[model samples]
Target: MVAVKITTVSTRLRRSMRAHDDYAVRVGRRRLLVTVTAHPGVARRWVHTTLWRHARRLRSVDGITVGMGVQWTPPFRAMKYGAEPRPCTLQLCVGHRCLVFQLAHAGAVPAVLRRFLADARAAFVAYGVRSDCRKLEEHHGLKVARGVELRRLTGMGNASMERMQCRS
Candidate 1:
């Protein structure tokens, strides 16, 4: 038997809401403070500090949880004719902090983000991570040097898991 943990974050925004917001998300048994923003500066600062903190603590950064949302092209006549999906949002979670970047509003991808993604020492963890990395490369020219796919780790194939049970 195997046990897998998953976390989800959700929030409703008003019509006149600001570009940045904070929410508490539960990851496993801990509550994480997540910041959602469309500003490149804020995202860069957070990633910079996070990498610095991890470097000072362990000399290497790893176990970064990553998730992304894509805007699919409209389906008209045939599925094959539809344009490739465009990545809209990227979310990263580490320790008690999570940062959600709205890529559409962020304009260009930040230099810090590019460096972070390209860092070989930093391992990004996600389900179907290869596709995520591919999208980043294809859309933003960002290369992710290392990543760990949870689906492969758990041997779960393409099945979605909300809650996993383990037998000891």
Candidate 2:
């Protein structure tokens, strides 16, 4: 993903307050919120072909790169015993579509999904991407060949802001 240097500044400021959330613009990643609810589904090995068909329709339109994220609870000692663990939720945002799917088990991935991920590596805009890509590869065998790390790009933005303020 190409890094755009310009900051999306707003002059019409409104005072607001909010609690501390990981969703806040952290120093490392710039995660945007999804206001609209994401559609949900489950990934089953038997449904790999079905999943691939679904994935092909994911990037139907041109020029818009896909944005994706995952939510999951780490296995703790108390939750580790004799019970089915909660599934990891995968969130995907394409042009005008949003989807949330629970990954039942890893490694039964669709080929088209893998291809979409590979394409996203070069085209998508996402936050904390390295670990996300790693998780995709480690858990689902999807390798992201190359991509822009927004942490670095946004770090540059911060640096530029400070420099401008100092001059002002």
TM-score of 2: 0.45
Model 1 TM-score relative to the real fold: 0.72
TM-scores of the models, in the order given = 0.72, 0.45
lDDT of 1 at 64: 48
Report how far residue 151 has shifted in candidate 1, in Å. Answer: 1.6
Q: Write the per-residue lDDT of candidate 2 for residues 61-119, one digit (tens) a residue.
A: 53335566756677776654554334365566544334445454333455555565566
Clashing pairs in 2: none
Quote the positional error of residue 36 for candidate 2 in Å: 12
Task: Write one digit per residue (lDDT tens) for candidate 1, span 53-113.
Answer: 6765435343444443334344345545534566777888777777888876787778998
- lDDT of candidate 1 at residue 107, scale 0 to 100: 71
